[model samples]
Target chain A: MANVRLSSIKKSFGKTDVLHGISLDVASGEFISLLGASGCGKTTLLRIVAGLESVTAGGVEIEGVDVTRLPPEKRDIAMMFQSYALLPHLSVSENVRFPLRMRGIGSREEQAEKVAAALETVQLDHLADRRPRQLSGGQQQRVALARAIVSRPKVLLLDEPLSNLDARLREDMQVELIEIHQRLGLTTIFVTHDQEEALSLSDRIVLLNGGKIEQEGTPAEIYSQPETGFASNFIGSANLLPAEIIDGETGPVAKFSDGQTLQLALEVSARGPVTIALRQEDLSLDANGDGPKAKVRTRVFLGARNRYVLGLAGEPLRALTANDVEFSAGQSVGLSIDPQRIRVLPR
Target chain B: MNDRTESLLLALPGLLLLVLAFFMPIGQMLILSVSGPDGVTLSHFVRFLSDPFYLGILWRTVRLSLVITIICAAIGFPLAYIMARVGPKLRLWLVVMVILPLMTSVVVRTFGWMVLLSRSGMIPEMLRDMGLVGRSFALMQTEAAIVIGMVQVLLPFMTLSILGVITRIDGRLEEAARTMGCSFLQSFRTVVLPLALPGIVAGSLLCFTLSASSFVTPNLLGGTRIQVLAASIYKSVTQTPDWPFAAAQAVILFAGILLVLVPYIKMTGPKDG
Candidate 1:
């Protein structure tokens, strides 16, 4: 296991820049996630670290060695593509042993042993002799993971490897990934666009937007305290409302453009124009309460929870409620949220 | 009518044409092969097989065809892989270049080879100037000339067949191989080659059969000294005026192709397992 440090990496295609100048330092054996929406260059950044793509400028150092100009084969890294990219001609055992065979990691007997251990780790030992084409999607994904870990490279790069599986399989693989990381302690860099996957997997989440770092922190730190409206909206998908904060006789109160006033947390000392972001699950909906009155525009049934879209103070708001709390469309309801849960951002 | 019957009815004319045009000639040749001057006999078959001269010609034909097939495969595989990996526009250009020789008539192409391989040809002259070969050297009227001409004529069939298969191979497999620690060429050899075996086998079969049966290029480039089965069969009928002997040779050629093909088809045949 080793640390990966990327300093001022930038990539561009012709006149269009995909990644702006960016820098990041991942400590030894840390699981760092580069999370963003599509076209945010998170995959590009991961590919650069894997040596699959060249940096337009700046350096990539793996285990304190400058490997910026090295080819993927020369770099001590293994990447798992989202497509699985298993060799169709080889059996599952051979696929898992490929990195060992290519890198000349061990003798034939040792390679076979490693392959067996890797397959057992992924719970695919029985299907060792079967070709990749014979395996199902989830089985193929496990084989890919086995192949990536067989070499025990300095760094493990996964490019949205779980995106192809179904939701249940994704969850299972996520837990498996965590266990594997714990057992092997390989410095892993996972690139994904799913915020929830990033939140659940990474020791540190580096949120990216428009090819630049928007925020970087632990999942709880980033989620609980988003610094910008974009970060707030992207992370929790919170509803942003333009507002003005002023010092009141008490602590501070935020006034929306529609004239609804809500108390702010004492920690928020900023007064003047600002934006308030309220998470959907943080809002509590009641039919007979004295909180901010809002009209329910739509309700989405989400198994155990129902998400209600409401129009509050002339702006749209979303709140998650228990499935038992039934509210018809166009019905006016009161919405309440803890002042601590509200995130206020400067305009 | 039902769809199956209707489709068969629509295909009747082509099937009838094939039976009349293809099967009828083969049937006639089979009849003539068994016929003799006095009565039906196996004298022609026994005579051809027993003679060292005729046996040498048969041996030469088989040897040359094998060499041509191997050469075509050697060059066609990497060429097809390049075509499959390149951008679409370049791929179109590559396809045109591969099949360009097939567009020209065989007689013209053979003459072009004759010019290039002759004693005074550009190739021999350049080699002599470079002191690589003696001044009396010539590539024409030799087995080397025949193999070269046949490979050039049949390379397109070999390459395009493989290209069609290689393009359908998912590119992600190579990328995955790289991450698995394979270099670019290693991935091509290990991953792309095995996946493209069906195409290679198919192309080899076609190249072998076509080179075995070919006449014009081999006749012109190889001259009268080096004779293949097709040229020998042609001489028996046209030059020697021996129709029965010619028919016997033709039957042998037909049987030889089928003899080589049955095992090949079995190797690639659909698996009931």
Candidate 2:
């Protein structure tokens, strides 16, 4: 295992700049996730580290050696593609043995032994001789994972490898990925657009926006304390409301456009126009409660809970409440949230 | 009518064409091969098989066809791969270039090769000037001349068949191979060549069959001195006016082609289906 460090990497395709400049350092055995929306250049960053893409400027150092000029084959790294690009012509056992064969890791018999052990790791030992086409998507994904880790490369790169699985399969694979990381202790860089996947899998989540790092922190720290409006909005998909922060007798108060006011935490020092990010689950709805009032526009039944879309000062705000709480359209409902849960950012 | 009957009715014209335009001529040839002036006899077959000269012609035809097919595949595979990977506009232009010779008449194409392969032609003159050959070196009217002309004539068939298959191969497979520690060339060999085998086999079959039966290009480039089987058969029909002997040779050629094709079809056919 080795640490990977990317310093001031810039990439451009033709005249359009996709990655402005990105610098990140991942510790050995750390699982770092590059999470962003489509077109955010997270995959580009990962590819640069994998040596699949050349950097326009800057250097990539792995294990303190500058490998920016090296091709992917020369670098001691293995990557798993999102498509689970198993060679169709090779059987499952051969697919898992590809890296070992290419890297010239061991003798033929030793490679066979390792292949069997890797297949056993993925619970695919019974289907070793079957071609990739004969396996299902999840099985193919396991084979890809086995192929990636079989060689015990210094760094493992995964490009949204779990996005192709269904919900249940994705969850099971997520748990398995965590276990594999813990067992192998390989320095892994996973690229994904799913915030939940990044949250659950990575030791540090680097949220990117518009080809720049928007925020970087542990999942819990980034989730509870998103610093910017975009970070707050992107991480938890928090609803943003335009308001003015005013110093009140007790603490800071946020006044919306329609003259409704909500109390903020005492530690908030922001003044003037600001956007308060309220998470969906943090907001509470009550029919006979003393709090800021809003008119309910619609309520969607989500089986375990109901998500109420409410109109607050001509803006739509959504809140998740218990399914037992019933409210009709056009009904005026009280919206309350913990003062400390609101994230205040400059508008 | 029901679906099966309707489909059969729709296919009746094609089926009739196959029976009349294809099987009728083959049936006539088969009958003629066994017929003689006095009675049905195996004498012509026995005579052709026993003659060392005729046997040499048969062996030369098979040998030249195999060489041509192998050469076409060796060149066509990489050319098809390049065409598949290039941009569409460039690929279209390349496809046109590869197919241009096929659009011309075989006679015209053979004449073009004759101009280049003859003693006074551009190729031999260049070779002589470069001191690569002796003054007596000549390419025309030789097996090399036949192989070269046949390859140019049949390269399009080989290239296009492989291109059709290579274009469908997922490029990501190569990228995955690269990340799995394979160099680009290694990946092309291990992943691409195996995947493209069906196309190569198909193209080889086509090249072999076409070159084996082709008369004009081989007869022209090879001259009368270096006669292939098809030219011999043509001589028996046109020069000697021996219809039964020609029919017998044609049947042998047809049978030889099927001998090479049946096992090939069995090997690759079921996998695709």
Best candidate per lDDT, number? 2
Q: Highest TM-score, which number?
A: 2
lDDT of 2: 0.93
Per-prediction interface RMSD in Å: 1.6, 1.7
| Superposed model 1: Cα runs more than 4 Å off | A248-250, B271-273
Worst 10 residues of 2 chain B by lDDT: B264-273
Regions of candidate 2 where Cα sits further than 4 Å from its true position: none
Candidate 2 local lDDT, B1-273, one digit each (tens): 899999999999999999999999999999999899888988789989999999999999999999999999999999999999999999999999999997888888899999999999999999999999999999999999999999999999999999999999999899888888889999999999999999999999999999999999989999999898899999999999999999999999999999999988987786631
Candidate 2 lDDT tens digits, A117-206? 988888999999998998899999999999999999889999999999999999999999999999989999999989999999999999
Per-chain TM-score, chain A, candidate 1: 0.98
DockQ, 0 to 1 scale, candidate 2: 0.71
**Compared with the true structure, what per-residue lDDT tens digits does model 1 show for residues A1-347?**
34888899999988889999889999888999999999999999998998888999999999899999988888889999999888877889988988999999999999999999999999999999998888899999999999999999899999999999999999999999999999999999999989999999999999999999999999999989999998999998999998899876668988877777888888888889989999998999989976778999999999999999999888999899999899999999987889999998889
lDDT of each: 0.91, 0.93
Q: Which candidate is the best by DockQ?
A: 2
Of the true interface contacts, the fraction found in model 2 is 0.83
TM-score of the first chain of model 2: 0.98
